[model samples]
Target chain A: MIAAPRKLPAPWVLRTFVVLILLLVWEIAGRHGSQLLFSPLSKVLTSGLQIFAEAEVLEALKTTAWILVVGFVLSVAIGLVLGLTVSMSRFTYQTFLPVLLLLYAIPQITVLPLFVLYFGSGPASKVAFGVSHGMFPIAVSVIAGVQGIKPLLVTSAISMGASRWQIFRRITLPYLTPSLFTGMRLASTATLLGVLLAELYVSAGGIGHLTRRFGENFQPDKLYALIAALSLMAILINETMRMLERRYSRWL
Target chain B: MSGASSAGQALTLRLSKSQKRLSLLVKIGVLVALLAIWHLVTVDEFVSPFFLPKPDEVLRVFFNIIVTGQAWPDLKVTLFEFALAGPIAVIAGGAVGFLISLTRYGTRAFEPIVSSVYAIPIIIFYPVSVMALGIGPESKIAHGALFGFFPMCLSTIQGFSRVDPLYIRLAHSTGASKSQLFWRIMLPAAAPTILTGVRLGLMLSFLAIIGGETIASLEGIGHRIVWYAEGMQTGNMFAYIVFVIMVAVLMNTALSFLEIRRGRQ
Candidate 1:
């Protein structure tokens, strides 16, 4: 039986109203609550600005950004190449896919200490850790994307006298773009998580060290502000990639 | 003509089968080659033992840890924290999500906020959690719950919101009470999605707890790795890493099985 259509509520207006109310409540609660856990919104705002004033915090931001970019690029490039090679032949896919998945399933975090041990407590360890974490998702997604191509499509192209290069360039590349974008999105998040976690763990030089310092000093305001800033950066990067995914998917 | 064509096809099939066998051999050869290289490099002292311990040493250490039962306490603590955090996250996330889904407007109002906040890796708040809860299992629990909460809540909302309205209307027309309607219609319909959320939450909860242990604290699997690493006990660290990965895999498998069972019901 066909169900009668129900009216969906006005989502935008309702969401806006809820957000405003939450902000108002937060402002009031922050203003009145104990100073330890709840810094007023205004105080946090000012402290956030002051955090940017510190050269070290700015440097940490720069370092984190650089690692994220490098790690993400490496993961995508390596993943794409490996994925293509493995998917090129059914024999390779059968022989290697299980092994790849086993490695992927292992909590890479378990070997994070090994990474630090081998690479030392430097950006190298962090980048290596990030790459290890980020590469798996991209590889898995790319394999899925490549393997998902219908055999009929390839057969049809071959029957029409399309050259190997022509088939790959025109048919395979376009079909894989959406999956590639999805892989990038996952890789970006994984890379950020890996880099940030490694940075925090190493605690020699970076935001992790700064976080430890603030925690030890009981500089809750500074710590809160710093975390907030980093969270915003993460959110911004995530949103930008999400937007790109949407835009690309629409064209596809 | 038919015999010749069949013979050609058979030859092609045999050629493909041999190619497959060759590829399998190559794959195994590659793995063995890698291990050989690792052994050689470490034995030659080109790479420091501290940096990359020989495979034999790692295996010996693993055997020692297993024999001595040195890893039990850390394993227990990590499991204990996970046991506590997983249920709390499911209940809290589910209750809150259910409340929010009661009204059409509420679902629209809260889901976006929940999802956007979730998009940010909540691990950044780990320090804050430590500050508030101190460096112990409590902070880990808090972090785990927070990490697990978003996915659970989002899926719960999706689950309940997608419950067919026709069922609700039929229940009401049949003079079913509010309690009966909710229990018979809403909860049952939403159970699969809710279970899916719980499964996702369980996985994230373990990851966050391990992360929290690694970043801080004196206990748990993650802490054990760091503890051994700092002590320059490379072999024990490798053993603990294996143990942790095994536990993660087991937990994931169990949860997915539970999800499938619930979906069937």
Candidate 2:
């Protein structure tokens, strides 16, 4: 297995080459293939740029963004508080964790209608849905973070006359940071999913309406461009979370 | 020292038993409280029945739908899509993942791309599937299979890539045939992780199928809910939601049971 001596292109170069080829194929297929289903890359890109310049699409995007931000921030805040309180004592943890797991396990999509029914088709429903999706991972991870701290460290701190606050501040906080970041990364994706699902389900206004309009009207170029823009936004948010996770993971 | 430790262990065990009982009591209490609150909110029109149907009404509608067999067609469609998608995802993903794991360079080149793609919410591609496959079960199946593929591929790559080299070396020295070496040593070694991937893939495929139907399907369980909601049949909609949740929970439980049983073996 080790006998062969060979040289190969670097991984990044290979990846770039593969991507370029795929793009080329897509462009060709769009031009030559069925006009009803496919849009050329150039057309999609230009449409994407043009749509961003439109006030209507911009408003929709802004609404979506607002819901995502609000929901995620609320999730982090609520999740931290809940996780900390639950993990504060064995009784609370035992009593509450199964409930959280039960709620989490429910296929939340089933309740999309209910959410819209209660909160209407506006931002309120989307934000609520996003928080419901995002908060669980954070709370579970935070509990795990607290639980994972070595008892020996706490004992040693106690022997050195550290107060409870001091022990928690020094040991627990640092230990939790890495896992907390990991939770945030997971939460970011979940929140986006929840918000987007709500948006799409409503089909009244915002990104969902735009997509449906584009799809039904047979505007493949506009449809592809809109999806691409949303995907780019998702990637940027996900990458930021991933970077934060990596930065904090050094502690673990 | 042994006697003292044994006594301590017994005490702790007794304490744990009491704790378990207490936790169960608390759980039951919490559920009851939630149901009570829900009832209270609807009792005197504190909340609109149009928005939140009473528990009794929802239960009646649920039973009515089940008894009338209104749910059968949608249920069948959903299950059919899941069955088709699940196998497609497993075979395609497993084959590709196995091939990738055969070379370190292949694993290095593809694993990151696969994972990053997985991170993006794949629902964005639903419209594309609709465009290509139309607003039918085919699109839902395709979407589900695509969604399920990533986890299966990633886990399979991870499972095979991390197998102990020493075990392979030992098999080779024993002059085992290639097929025997793979089937006996590699397959069993990788089975647990691969099984986990399978479970995840099937679950995600099921969820994706339902989600796809919700997004743009003519008929299915998800579509039924949307239809009811648009018609403002809140009671019936609630009933459908409850039914779907039950199905999901049962599927999740059954998968977990299989995973645990196999893990024990």
In model 1, the Cα lDDT at residue B109 comes to 69
Q: Where in model 1 is the C-alpha error above 4 Å?
A: A1-9, B1-33, B43-46, B162-190
For residues A34-83, write the lDDT of model 1, one tens digit per residue.
67766666777787569888898889878888888899999999888877
Task: Report, to 2 decimal places, the DockQ of model 2.
Answer: 0.42
Q: After superposition, how far is residue B1 of candidate 2 from its true place, in Å?
A: 39
Model 2 per-residue lDDT tens digits across residues B1-265: 0223422333342337788898899999999999999899998879898888898899999999889998999999999999999999988989989987776777776777777777878777787788788999999999999989999999898888788888888999999998998898888888887888888999999998998888799998988988899899988999999999999999988987887677556
- Clashing residue pairs in all predictions, respectively, total 0, 0
Model 1 sits at a Cα RMSD from the real structure of 6.1
lDDT of 1 by residue, B27-114 (tens): 7888899899989999988988777788888778777777987888988998899999988899899989988888777777688778
Task: Rate residue A172 of model 1 by lDDT.
Answer: 85
Best by DockQ: 1
TM score of chain A per candidate:
0.89, 0.93
TM-score of model 2 relative to the true fold?
A: 0.92
Candidate 1: clashing pairs of residues = none
